[model samples]
Target: MTTTPDAGLRQDRHLATEIPGPLSQALMARKDTAVARGVGTTMPVFAARAAGGVVEDVDGNVLIDLGSGIAVTTVGASAPRVVEAVEQQVREFTHTCFMVTPYEGYVAVAEQLNRLTPGTHEKRSVLFNSGAEAVENAVKIARAATGRSAVVAFDHAYHGRTNLTMALTAKAKPYKHGFGPFAPEVYRAPLSYPFRDGPDVDGGAAARRAIEVIEKQVGPENLAALVIEPIQGEGGFIVPAAGFLPALQEWCRDNGVVFIADEVQTGFARTGAMFASEHEGLVPDLLVSAKGIADGLPLAAVTGRAEIMDAAHAGGLGGTYGGNPLACAAALATIETITADGMIERAREIEALALARLERLRDADPRIGDVRGRGAMLAVELVDPATGAPDAELARSVAAAAHAQGVIVLVCGTYGNVLRFLPPLAISDAQLEDAFDVLAATFTELS
Candidate 1:
């Protein structure tokens, strides 16, 4: 398929050699010494160039990308608009530091965020370097606005790797293992895990259960905010029951607690809706966004009601490089791409294509205990057929097989049994079908 010259890589998947051929292996050896041990890669193949739906590795293998750099590159690895914008911005100026000199790109980005984020109410935005930073700032604004200390995150939540966000996150091994004494005043509540929690509890019931926990453990009067992902990301592509988010939001409003929607992974048309929060009309008090916002640039933002966002003092809210001009230009262009390119509908089309395949697999294979998610962001939970217990080994085997066959997939969950698929909206129907063919074969082989 033809693509822009800037996005020079092809859209097709072609394995020129073994998965991680000698060149990649040599690079891996170098990376072992040069990079920190804490950083880990899902696929061993080193990328030489990437564009559209495929990533070309150092060994010349063009592998179909299903993970999309952990839901970052929604438009494509090298989308034309994003590339053009960044190229133009770099030629003009890379960074003057918005805090010191100020610029149009940063203000334009903030304006876009305020306008595009859910809710028609007057909103304000602040930029940051990462999702964790956006979330930290959101919490700060919440506390400043409400004069409260405690914030509640849900079970199976994956916030970020920072000190405060580590306390906010639910998983402990990799993200929070040795990082204690974590930031204080952070609490965890239960999430509406439909597959595991069983059939009896619907969204409302699950919300009440969580509310009860919040009320008992950390009272409403003491709470600053209740942060959540409408569709949980690293906690598995967990889509909570229909009314759960609204229920929690209403409670937050009544209790004078800020409702923060951490849309780091679910925003910017990743789900069928522009924001996953829109699925149920969840107009959060504050929305922390990153990942897909800048088409792979290091950018994040917290958009919220004007009053709450303005609570923080002028000197209290910014960093030297929070809103780099290049990143802002990328964000503006990415937003334009999403709107002009009909990416929201593309995400729905992907949902229709992938969900049907996954549902059929679930129906045929007992090991596929659950297949759930929204739009391009989808996942399947692997479980033991006999006992219905989580089969993390099976998940790993399936992922490894997919990787060996030149398809990129990622495994995540509290139990580590969920295989999440987040293909770029730019992915072709043929490439997606081919990836699924490989996945089907891998599952059958493992079975």
Candidate 2:
């Protein structure tokens, strides 16, 4: 319940002018010239400072932050503990390269990953700079251990944007449109999207169908890994049906394929659980983590069974800035805050508030085809009411409308019809209510 000092500004939404007011519009011009065209932004307003649940823009507009920078700032951007840790670490030696000289902070983070990641088995961890790197390393470990080449990913899965990860990812438009030729040997299986798959196709049936596809398309013996997000992230916050994860884990166990849980988005209590796998009692052989790991700093990890992680020969894994001292320090403080500051319980509370509000919204709107996901990682899928077709335009309109009113929202899904809500765990209930009010108003205005 600790709040960061607001520096004489209140922690409530306050719009001094229209969003992206004069100053922000000027910055946007500069960004257009300096930044890459491929890079996209959700809000045009450049953030000057952020604390708790609000981000103050360059134009002095206080906007309610619902996206959390794509769920990276779970502890809130500029969290006191994380900032303090980073400052202290920077004063100390910043980097000696963990692979070359080594440091305690790196080992400490690896130890934390080993302990925090699911499974009581002997675990080892390797640090990476991003979720994509962690996923690629997980695949490497699986292949090295099993000596198999083919990897199985789900239909709506989003692993990362790296060459191998892009191959594992399902969406092709933005993530993989012109980025080919992608890496080979990655296969996609049917995911249990209950909303789209009809009522009869439950978790067990979905698992069977996916397994059948794997058997036919990529032989079980040839598969090195079965990578999945226990609660899917960018491919819309699609939470697979119950028993789907457990069944997949069992299949991976029965076959030689390693079960890798890509908890990049769902990790660190974003999904109302310590890890999304715990919801179904799944024990993935490899667990990938990032995003909320370091409270916005670049840090990712692959924690898995010791034997599998050690399958690679000496010096086979690692990067120059894999576990930078500052990032490690930030991660340690972030984890401590999550555990000691009751953020996990806060996540469950957030889930309750968000679902209650969103379910009400869905009840009133026919265009809302589905309201799904868990904890703070909730999303609403927009669809044409009459024909039941995905309505990407409606989704975009609602998000843009919300953004214009000083509430930052983000859109996702393969069809671009999902409006994801990833409020920070540290966000107050009042802030949440205010954001949802804006959301409701947007829907009312558009519908």
Candidate 3:
């Protein structure tokens, strides 16, 4: 049921009301009363409908989308292929509980994931409902395989909110703050942040330092796995140097620990390659995939060396909705579109346009600290003019100003000063130019 990418979507804007309007305000008041207090807000812009690269808010404001719902909807929002696949799958059945009633869709998806992810060795895959679940299950597989309890993660890493992953995550504020009794035996080390950690220090040196830390702190032999994102997502799209991933993977082989690539945000052609890990040609022992897997359906996966994957008890990895038929069917369509519809090439084109705009900003302004990323997964770090401190406020202001001008942008970083662009690969050239122009205007306004 999966169709090809079609821009048959037309943008329509009707604003008889404020940005939030009256109805949305009422809904917000009720939402504030009922929704969890600690929830994070993204522009407070309530969406009524979205298709392609434009999202229509409840207030009828049509805004150009640059976030792609946190890098999930890569092919595009309400992509015909995705919608049709979901619709047809839902009509047939929503949930069969893959474990309870095995289906071909789930197996087909698993087969695709194993084949598509990095490496040519014999591989196996398990499906889950979220990136966090996939990550946790990968760790479970590593522990079961090695009979070791220690796990090592990098600083500035953003794994997930689960108790164990939270412990693995490096950021302290929202994700890990006050949420401890964090899982034990989790160790953190400094990762290569070339922009800030120092210019001379590249990936190889950082990898050595990280390995030393593990051997000294956790003892390499006792460690079960070293989980890292090929391109750190929430911690800023910090693309590690060319040699970093290969070095780390080598170390894992020398030592007896599994190498897990948490590609939840970097998978499905987000980084020009099929998987970000493939950018460096390093095959991780286990890879976690989700977000863009099902084109917005809740789905995730863990694919790895078959021996490591099969180490656990037969029923060790699964969830009730882990491989829902609806999600699985959608995954099939989404993967097919990404691989066959030339979305990966489009992702590179997006990078070319975004890099050009960001480079201009960098050349024109010192406040723009750095512009770094591959493919559509790009971000610009902001810094104070004189002191060179992270200009977090300016980043936030730019995002707000862009939103006011009918463009939605997302900002994130360990220092809270980077504006990341993760637009859908199916986004058009004109839309990309329009988005760049809006960002340029905002930069001038802010200056």
- For each candidate, the alpha-carbon lDDT, in order, equals 0.93, 0.92, 0.87
Q: Candidate 2, residue 102: CA error in Å?
A: 0.7
Off by over 4 Å in 3: 1-9, 12-18
Candidate 2, 210: how far from true, in Å? 0.1
What tens digits encode model 3's per-residue C-alpha lDDT throughout 372-410?
999999999999878779998999999998877777799
Q: Which of candidates 1 and 2 is the stronger one according to lDDT?
A: 1
Per-residue CA lDDT of candidate 1, range 118-180, in tens? 999999999999999999999999999999999999999999999999999999988999879
Model 2: weakest 10-residue lDDT segment is: 1-10
Per-residue CA lDDT of model 2 for 1-447, tens digit only, reads: 354645665678899998779999999999899999999887889989988888899888998989999999998888888999999999998889999999999999989988888789999999999999999999999999999999999988898999999999999888999989999999999999999998999999999999999999999999999999998889988989899989999999999889999999999989888898999999999999999999999999999999999999999999999999999999999998998888889999999999999999999999999999988999999999998899999999999999888898999998999999998898999999999999999899986
TM-score quality measure for candidate 1: 0.98
lDDT, candidate 1, at 38? 97
List candidate 2 stretches off by more than 4 Å: 1-5
> Which segments of candidate 1 are over 4 A away from where they belong?
1-8
